[model samples]
Target: MPQMSPLSWLILFMVFTLSYLGFLTMNYFSTFYSSKTPSQININSTSHSWKW
Candidate 1:
């Protein structure tokens, strides 16, 4: 097998790290919001944090 250089290892690590960050960012920040009534909205705002 061919040996990999330090630069190649660093580049691979960076690529994986950035991809993981991007994945988490999109997963957490992106949400599905359907049309909700005013009462439902008020209840959600007043209640404690529970995304699920």
Candidate 2:
């Protein structure tokens, strides 16, 4: 078997870290929004959060 260098190990660690962070962030945001009431409960556009 071939021995892996330190540089290769570092690169692998960084890739794994970034992907894990992204997965966690998505889960957190989804859970947060799912528990909130709809922001469009007010039919009036002037009172809506998406006012143009």
Which predicted model would earn the best TM-score? 1
Stretches of model 1 off by over 4 angstroms after superposition: 1-4, 32-52
Residues 12-31, candidate 1: write the lDDT tens digits: 99999999999999998798
Q: Write the per-residue lDDT of candidate 2 for residues 1-52, one digit (tens) a residue.
A: 2366777889999999999999999998777443546884656557646767
Q: Which stretches of candidate 2 lie over 4 Å from their true place?
A: 1-4, 33-52
Clashing pairs in 1: none
TM-score versus the correct structure, for each prediction: 0.52, 0.51
> For candidate 2, which ten residues in a row score worst on lDDT?
32-41
Model 1 global lDDT (CA atoms, 0 to 1):
0.84
Tell me the whole-model lDDT of each prediction, alpha carbons only.
Answer: 0.84, 0.79
RMSD value for candidate 1 = 9.6
